[model samples]
Target chain A: MELQAIGVQHPAVRQVQHIQNNTAPNRYKLFVAEGLWAHNMLLEANAPIDTFFWCPEAIYADEAHRRAEEIAARAERSFRVSLRTMEKMSERDKPDGLLSLAALPRWEPSDLRFGRTSLVLVADGVEIPGNLGTLIRSLDACGADCLVLTNRKTRLTHPKVIRASQGTILTVPTVEFEETGEAIAWLDRLRFTVLLADTDEAVNYRQADYSGRTALVVGSERYGIGKEWYGHGYQRVAVPMLGSGDSLNVSVSASVLLYEAKARKANW
Target chain B: MELQAIGVQHPAVRQVQHIQNNTAPNRYKLFVAEGLWAHNMLLEANAPIDTFFWCPEAIYADEAHRRAEEIAARAERSFRVSLRTMEKMSERDKPDGLLSLAALPRWEPSDLRFGRTSLVLVADGVEIPGNLGTLIRSLDACGADCLVLTNRKTRLTHPKVIRASQGTILTVPTVEFEETGEAIAWLDRLRFTVLLADTDEAVNYRQADYSGRTALVVGSERYGIGKEWYGHGYQRVAVPMLGSGDSLNVSVSASVLLYEAKARKANW
Candidate 1:
């Protein structure tokens, strides 16, 4: 529980700057957040944050101080650092006093098993960290199976994605693949219906059966799941968008589909 | 069309950074993104956008270009800008030159009149811009009857929220309310079965009878519809979030409930 302010300024704090970069290929073993909510999320998640420093100047809500004290007590070690050190590592314009690096929870696809899987979501070519995080959060909310990802998309190792996920990324297991076709095939082998979302689909999403193990595939908003993969066993299913606009944000679209699937199967 | 670079270096953009900042209330009269897919949705909606831009750097198939050009052709006026401009406007570091701007659309609550008024979505205290946008996008996808917005949240004129709505905001005749409780009373007088989303509600969302005229009410995530106003014939309902953590993000939870209503009524 050693206390150290990890910022991008000081050589000691700046050392973790590489981890802070969203573009980095590997996940940061430690994540330093500037806000009270994020730090609390990590603490509540029991994420093994090795160390954290509470700044004297950091604002505390009514519950925040009590929670911080409890988190500090539980920390194998803790630090009471100065606001100056936090400023050195503060990535944003506003750097709060409480900075902590919680250990990220490890996950795998098998960990996402659901009872009688209805409509699970699969994402490919979603390269934006925030979009991916939002997608994961939606998947978790809609009770979809693991969000299968492709290497071509942004990996969840990024801190922004975790923040955007609002901490749900820690809960949602993912299945990533170099070959999306293989991923599709794997879903096919499992007898799960593969439904690809596109504008030109012959079947509307409502018409598609999501009452069983299903893989709803959504592509990057920029580039949809291309015909190369589209012609596979997948059935192109489009949501019935009656508006002038033809599509939803990738994550929102996925949410609609997931809600439909869960609703039907659950008879909600 | 007269094209203006209006460099990011230009001071005008940041003059009054937050349009919602009370002094800047007039900002709504200026350029505003009005629909879901405000960026992506506008294309589907053929919403009148000033231009189209994307980061020329991201790797994508020809479909991306084809779609971009298609959308541009449909815009009120269109042009191709550079990755630099795209980067400045887009949050994602990798610009897709898909940036666009359009005048916000106007709305009236009466426009949401539907068949037997079986289901509808009413959002109050929905302060988060992206959540509002995402909700609009989902409302369109889930085919909810009109989206209602009250004064408790971000201004609908914000471009980011419109972009998130994916053009649904453009299609849906959303009504604005200064007071949500008053609006609920109006719907109540109309005989709509009002359902309030509560984190502590005992009735599971799936158990609700969505077959009749139903109004789905949701509060802001940060401060859920304050407890002060409740129990006035507004049946409180809750979504069964399988995960043990915090409740679903507001937008996700709303989408789930909306689609569940869609499903039960669909008799799926």
Candidate 2:
């Protein structure tokens, strides 16, 4: 079993131990399971898991071990490992003994097609791993159809992301585009109204038409949107910042925009 | 200068010697000025700065450095550290050469009086320093009057909170509460309506009237606000989360709630 190869004694494991540098997950269309919370969240999301690992510490006594065994019995593939090794693999210092390599969630943006108009989030060149995770979580909570990442510098398959995303990346239609300008052009071709959140914009976010097939485009925290979208025909809206700060976290901005869209769509 | 004792030797002086850790800044109320961008934001926000540590590798070589010099000149106290020491103090290994130590801003909540009604963010028992920082940043961006942390498990003085706020903690009004229940009672006595964002609440956040003196209360990411408010007649409202993910980042939830309040206040 592939599970046996991951044990500490196995020599092949060391070569590919770094999940960030490993392409096997994407190549084989597999997603690494994180800690127990992510495992449980995936199960709750009904996303498929291919293999499961149980670290020794995950169970306290014989009774708990029996429960762990019972749960493992439900999985098609499962294994047991020492706490030390599992802790090394985990992002968190202390992890519940369970981890799983879930099957890559098959995602399709076309599935987001709604009969009525809706607001969607389009992230342009978001390089930060944590921000990507937070943005996906926000998109899912606000009922956005899909989040399209255009030319991300950070690898989507990075293990840090899967851990940070609370496994919501599985449920969200996580798609990517080669270039943001091209993505915007495709949206324009589809006649989807686009809005850019620029600090220099005149119109307040609340004044926009978020009830339709509106797409809110946000850029990286570092460079923001480049020459691609500037002075384009898209409406530029800014959240009314009444105080002294320049901007909010890129992910928090996404959440605020998506929530605003939800509110406007529902006509609050 | 006290800065010399630390022997600032790093490239981007601030990056090599970042005050990102709670230990450094919390101990002395002295934080390392991170980057030109951050320092610029600080200037725009009118945050107090005690000294400036300039490095040659930094833009001081470029004409842009001339403008930066103007800002540096404004520092109440300033120093010139060798690029070597700047590198030592810098966290960014490359070392842009400039590191500044600024006294943490001292600000307090103004008299809790709203002439024409208002919207505010009230955080309760939030333990994550990053979450608190994000909350403060969102409040600053959304134009929320202030963030009140009552019954907080994490110190508002933690450096992660400062870093997470992108330095807005200095610009925003942050008040600590001995007890969330007591704070709510005080608000009630002062005619401030308390809207607690609870998971079990039936009322949608949008449905609530935020045009009044509103305080949007959020519990920690762990267990939310303690049930003490349940005894009080506080209005409980939650943002409508329409997805399978049961939890959102407490800060993300705060952003959504704050913006809703912003929208209502604008209309009001």
Candidate 3:
């Protein structure tokens, strides 16, 4: 294995930068994981890495350097780049000297599998990459089996999504739907009880039954859950807003409901 | 009342810019609220506005214009400025033609009042402005009585804090402590049960007693609760983390705990 030195104008560097900017059409086909935490999680999951780029001068931590070395050894292709080139390819003001472009795990409706008493989370029209990522983290914390994104607004491969999720975005089983109707139909076929977080004609979230196969649905701050999700047999539940705030942050609402569902299901 | 025309070089403009940059020594004495949502909130709360600045050319919405007029009529002082000058005074890239410099509500430990079965939140060492703001929004949502910030890193008057809080930061009675020991002693004296969100020797949060006068304490993501807070008869409780991530976002954790305490207190 040889360390090929690349400059700021290198095609590979340009490609990563375009992917980071999300200018590339195939951005969803691949994603970049920067910093030691995301890279360690990638290695821990043994996810396939298309390429690894490192700059010894940019990394400040010994642990990051070690992880970069480990990644260089294991990556299918590895490149050594100058600090300037690394900065061009990095998202943060300070580059950690390690970056990996890896294949994003793609799942379809058919790929989603469920068991008895399965827990699933459906995030609809969540625009903020950080919020989407935080929702995924909450879903993971509740030991939810899968995340199904419908009416998706932000790319799942967004760097903020990966970082805010604490790298669980790499490990969590996630699927996306192009249309809300498709997701509703699939969940209905699977007999998963769809619970929509709504403010009107809704039961207290605590009083709602989360037992059996459950799919907790939350919407973005701008738009409540889509109109398509309504008029269906889905149960509507509301977290009590006792003060001046119109509602809780979307991620906060989702986490509270997810934990409640998990507790009720486990009889904790 | 005639509106005084101002320029970018005006002392008031420079003072606001300094406060926005958090460079002013008395930054905590006044805070800026930008855009329509925060302005509407301030008006709804009847919060005192020391000064209001509006740009006719920059405002695009009719509702915003109406709100600006309403603010100008009620504000102690109002100014008309050029769009470029408004941009200089505004935080966002595109200013909504409204900004207010208002006196930050100052509360002290002695000012904190509680009722039987009161709910309070103590954020210890939370450094992120947005996280602190979101915690305040959650506190408001949970109908918590007051917010006590100890080991505070970011100013409560930070622009991001005011914005992220959805203006609840203005209404939520908040008090700050210079020392963690002072907060501890005050809570103890008040007979408020202090529950620390900790991972060690902690019971499941769902099983914890949130019935009496409860103060839910959360710490920064970097540092857990201060060591001084422990071994002082404070209860330790943990939200179950059933994922690869080490912990949830500080705001998410705080919101979950706050809602749980609220629900338990209301017997919902």
Q: How would you class the docking of model 3?
A: high
Candidate 3 lDDT, tens digit per residue, A143-165? 99989998989998888888788
Q: Candidate 1 - CAPRI tier?
A: acceptable
Give the alpha carbon lDDT tens digit for every residue of B28-145 in model 1.
Answer: 3334332123455555555566544433354255666556666556665544445564445555545453555554666566655567846777887888788888888778766777
User: Higher DockQ: candidate 1 or 2?
Assistant: 2
Best by the TM-score measure: 3
lDDT by residue for model 2 (A1-268), tens: 2234257554333322545357344554565665545656765677666666777566555644554554465566677777776765565666666666666565555545643666678888778787888888888777887887776777656676675566778887766677767777767766678889887854878788775588888888888865687767778888777766667888888788788878878765
For model 2, how does the per-residue alpha-carbon lDDT over B97-205 read when each residue is reduced to its tens digit?
4556666655444554555566778888888888898899888887776778777788665557767888777777766677666677667776788888986855888
Ranking by DockQ: 3, 2, 1
What proportion of the real contacts between chains A and B does each prediction keep?
Answer: 0.49, 0.76, 0.85
Best by DockQ: 3
**Per-residue lDDT tens digits of candidate 1, residues A168-194?**
776677777677667767777677887
Residue-level lDDT for A148 in candidate 2: 76
Residue ranges of candidate 3 with Cα displaced over 4 Å: none
Candidates' chain B TM-scores in the order shown: 0.72, 0.81, 0.96
Chain A TM value for model 1: 0.85
lDDT measured at residue A37 in model 2 versus the true structure, 0 to 100: 59
Q: Alpha-carbon error at A241 in model 3, in Å?
A: 0.6
iRMS, model 2 (angstroms): 1.7
TM-score computed on alpha carbons, candidate 1? 0.77
